[model samples]
Target: MKLKIINSDKILYEEDVFYLKAPGLNGYFQILENHTSFISILKKGNLKFKNKKKIKKNLNIEKGILKVNKNFIIILL
Candidate 1:
C-alpha cells in the first residue's frame, strides 16, 4: 500500500509499505493492503511500518491525524 507521512515542515516519508502500525488515541492499530477506509486521531508514540523488503521501520510522532482509503494512507503531523 502507498503511505505518506507529512509534517508542517516537510514530507517525512513516502513509500510503499506492507504493513503499518500507528498510535491511535485509545491505543494502537494497524493497516494492511486493501484495508477498509477510516480516519483516526493519533497520540504521541511510535509509528511503525514494514517495507516491501519486509524490513520494519519506526517513526516517533506527536499528536497527528491518520486517514486511510483504497490502499492509501496519509499521516498529518
Candidate 2:
C-alpha cells in the first residue's frame, strides 16, 4: 500500500508499505495490505510501518489525522 506522512511544513515520509501501525485516539490499530477504508484521529504516540523490503520504520508523532482510501493511506500532522 502507498503511505504518506505530512506535516504543515513538509513531507516526512512517502513510500509503499506492507504494514502500518498508528496511534488512534482510543488505541492503536494496524493496517495491512488491502485493508478497508476509514479515518481516525490520532493521539500523541509512535507511528510505524514496514516497507516492501520488510524493513520496519518508526516515527514519533504529535496529534494528527489518518485517512485510508483504497490502497492508499495518508497521515496529516
Candidate 3:
C-alpha cells in the first residue's frame, strides 16, 4: 500500500509499504495491502513499515490520526 505521513508544513514520508505497524488506542495493530478502509487514533510510539523493497524502518511519532483506504494511507501528526 502507498503510505504518506504529513504534518502542517510538509509531507514527511511517501512510499509503498508492504506492511504497517501502528499504535492504536487499545494496542498496536498491523495493516497490509487490501485491508479494509478505516480510521484510528495514534499514540506516541515507534511506527514500523515494510516497503515494497522489503526495507523496514522504525519512526517515532507523536499523537496523530491514521486513515486507510483501498489505495493509500494518510498519517497526520
**Candidate 3: which pairs clash?**
none
**How much is the lDDT of residue 34 in candidate 1?**
91
Clashes of 1: 0
Model 2 ranges off by over 4 Å: none
Candidate 2 shows a clash count of 0
lDDT-better candidate, 1 vs 3: 1
lDDT of 3 by residue, 23-77 (tens): 9889999998899999999998889998888899888998899999996999999
Candidate numbers, best lDDT first, in rank order: 1, 2, 3
TM-score of each candidate?
A: 0.96, 0.96, 0.95
Best by lDDT: 1
RMSD, each candidate, Å? Answer: 0.6, 0.6, 0.7
Q: What is the lDDT of residue 14 in candidate 1?
A: 96
Q: What is the C-alpha lDDT profile of model 2 across 1-77, one tens digit per residue?
A: 99999999999999999989999989999999889999999999999899999999999988999999999999999
Decide which is better by lDDT, 1 or 2. Answer: 1
Model 1 lDDT tens row, 22-68 = 99989999998999999999999999999988889999988999999
TM-score, candidate 2, is 0.96
